[model samples]
Target: MFGRTKTSGKTSTTAAATTDHEVREGAKGRPTPKRREAEQRNRRPLGSPARAAAVRPGASKEEKKAAREAERKVFAEERALQRQALVTGDERYLPVRDKGVAKRFTRDYVDARRNAGELFIPVAMVILLSSLIPVAVVVRASLVALYALVLWVIVDSFLLRRKLNRITVDRFGDKATGCATYGMMRALQIRRTRLPKPQVKRGEFPV
Candidate 1:
């Protein structure tokens, strides 16, 4: 029979104890972090809806009123500036009604001329009022004068168109197509009522 090997429980228990000590030593310096504290340190908030409310929300009565008032003030300021520019004929803020070098030249040409159409408004008012006269001779005379004046203005406009065409063709070449018509219309307007209010005075012709 083979000799039986001696076994000691002390040897087994000592080996297990040494293994446990090694594991504890490895984890001694580094403590496990708490989930709650880690989360708080790295927390992310939602983006800027509160700041957006100041610009987009006007549902309350006072807020709505304030928004409308602000809008009106802005509109009033724009109107005032536009009117001032129109009156002073500021080129930087000139309206669509009076933009472009061609238009400027047209205005200058019309203003410089001693045309019959300049007194058109008052003359037309007088002629229309006289046409209301019940007397046959006076009515007929006013109608004839009206026709004559219309004819004269038409003839003058034709001459004005030719002259503007010639001048513009000489200066701007192929771009004189609608400039004559534009100039003619400007010529017909009452000098006092023209918008962009004639920057050039009479006799101030621009080339």
Candidate 2:
């Protein structure tokens, strides 16, 4: 009876040890952690902004200010690059309207020639000032001249559109929509002021 009791005690001790081992294992990996614990672990992990703010209270302000200055420098560089792209015709930074081979081709075509439409802005300015004159003859002549200039610009733009359409169709197997209008608009802008600044020099016509 005594030996049997001793054996029972040993078996109970072994069972208790096994149960403790299982509990330890479960704590390590078996079950999911409580929500609060999990969230705390996730919210301020190493290298996170929140972690940095918490761990470095004394230096955080200076670090933040330095970080902001760095961001500003990066933004300024990007802005400069975008402006340069506008002048150099860099596709990566070009606006949506200026992106694409057809658009580039149209721009080049318009830039290669001196358009009559470019004179419209200056001429209209002159006509406006002349119309302000008290003299009746000057006002009437300016009105007539304005009408003639408008008609001439329309005719020139139409011709340009037709030529652009024909050329695009020949080259690309189909005419690109809005390309003619795009070309005409660019042609009307003063050469020096054109965006995606004129890739081709005057008289360097595209084949």
Candidate 3:
């Protein structure tokens, strides 16, 4: 009786193992290992190496010029629409202007106009001088002028502005004007020209 019980138990264990193997084989038919790997590859990010290789570079110079011309035409049409809306007081297109905002806008407009007029004559004179002189002479003069301007900008922007800040704090209890002056000095520095320096030879020292 003992041997017969042991043999029946071994046969049942083998049947259970066979049933588990069949379940795994059925799952393979539903979604295979290869299909899962393909799905993962398809979900890869756009900037990944594989995706980057598929993207084309930007257009050529002629194509870029054509695109720019098309954009300019669209901008002209938009400007015309805005102008028409403004003249007709179209509420849908025209935003309501606050009195304080309008005042500030007018002030800025007037200041810009006055500044441009003041600069016009000096700028015209410089352009005329540049046209009359040889390009090499003009370039040398410009480099010298640029060096001087950079030095002046460094001094006035950092030193003079700091002094102005102290004075403004002591007298007015406000530093707004000093800040504006410092900003103007910084703008001048940004607009200044940069000239290339002469390169020295391997065995030579710059004089």
Instruction: Go through the candidates in order and give each one's C-alpha lDDT.
Output: 0.74, 0.83, 0.45
lDDT of 1 by residue, 19-45 (tens): 776677555545667998888666653
Stretches off by above 4 angstroms in model 3 are: 1-132, 174-207
Models, CA RMSD each: 17.8, 9.6, 17.7
Candidate 1 stretches with Cα past 4 Å from truth are 1-76, 173-177
* Poorest lDDT segment (10 consecutive residues) of candidate 3: 190-199
TM-score versus the correct structure, for each prediction: 0.58, 0.62, 0.25
lDDT winner: 2
Q: What would the per-residue lDDT of candidate 3 be over residues 1-207, giving only the tens digit for each residue? A: 999999999999999887776777545544455877888667644533423333324556666566556666666776676665544434344423311222222222222221222333355457556656778877677666655645654664465446545544554453234343533333232121201111122234212
Model 3 quality (TM-score): 0.25
In model 2, which regions exceed 4 Å deviation? 1-76, 173-175
Task: Please give the distance, in angstroms, between residue 150's alpha carbon in candidate 2 and its true position after superposition.
Answer: 0.9
Backbone clash numbers for all candidates listed: 0, 0, 0
Choose 1 or 3, whichever is better by lDDT. 1
Report how far residue 54 has shifted in candidate 1, in Å: 11
Shift in Å, residue 91, candidate 1: 0.6
lDDT tens digits, residues 1-207, model 2? 999999999999999987887788435645678998897677653444544544543666767677556666666777898899999999888877888888888899999987989999999999989999999999999999999999999999889989988887677655467788889888899988999899899899887
